[model samples]
Target: MSQSTAKAAAADASASAALRARSEVARLISYIVIGSGAAFLSLRASTLPTSRWEPLGAGSFPELVFGVLAVLCLTAAVRAVIDIRKAGGANRLGTSFAKWLVARRYSFALFGLLVVYLALLPLGGFSLTTFVFLLIAQLMIAGISKKTLIQSLIAAMIFSVGLNMLFAEVFNVFLPRGVLFAG
Candidate 1:
């Protein structure tokens, strides 16, 4: 083969290898996230209160939902494992995982925001806390723009106050009234 042809072939091989490495890392992260989420949801559903009046009880719907989620998660994990095996099991994942995390820093930032939102909920009240969380999350995910900012504000208001009112009036479910606002 010509020297140029050999160099071109080498470059193509390098690019393909990089792509495969990224795909494997992505699959590993997905498997971990789905598996952990399923476990958490299942445990949370188990803690829900059961009603004596209903055969299935209050916990029934949550349990059913979480059960379905768990099944889907398991299915995805199995598929990932199969794919990994087919790709010769690239098991040296530590460096790739770190690179993936750095590449997707926004995801970790959003997760931190969610944790902060949960922690501040009781102290800030549902309406205020949810409004702020929605606004910030929307901005982070969608990026900043005049139109987006306006829409984000409206959406945040609707989700926070409107949903709260709907739940309290229609469903008769009262959301938490923060310690600051509690009568």
Candidate 2:
């Protein structure tokens, strides 16, 4: 394999081992969140009586989503445990996991951006949030460039406006407009 590829593989192995060594704590946390979410939804569902069109009433959607999330978390816990068990031996992962870790660097930035977007939605409108998110994302991956910044800002504006219009006008869904809407 290539030198970079080998280095990535080594990095992945080390990261996986480190993550696995702490799997028990991670698994416990996942179990708590997933279990609580699932149970809350389940209880909500039980409190609602069956309807003509929908059997589970208002609780069905949240319950279904929570149940699926719980199952996925449970699966993650199982895999983490398995990885921890097999980490010592020679049975290591190939390039797939290594490449995934590399790609996750960008994905994590996107995740942080989303968190900020959601948090700031109540303070600033979608347009402002999108502008900041795009600028930061572009800066993180490829260093600052005037052209890139302009393009990103324009794209962010279009996306934010388009999505806002679609959700508010077409879908009739309410989005947080922040203090701007109140004034």
Predicted structure with the largest TM-score when compared to the true one: 1
Quote the lDDT for 105 in model 2: 82
Q: lDDT value for candidate 2?
A: 0.70
Model 1 regions lying over 4 Å from their true place: 1-13, 22-94
Residue 46's lDDT within candidate 1 is: 78
Residue 42 of model 2: what lDDT?
A: 66
lDDT of 2 at 21: 52
TM-score of 2: 0.46
What are the runs in model 2 whose C-alpha is more than 4 Å off? 1-103, 165-174
Please write out the lDDT profile of model 2 over residues 26-46, one tens digit for every residue: 454566577777767767776
Clashes of 1: 0
RMSD of each: 8.0, 8.1
CA lDDT, candidate 1, residue 97 = 69
Q: Provide TM-scores for the models.
A: 0.56, 0.46
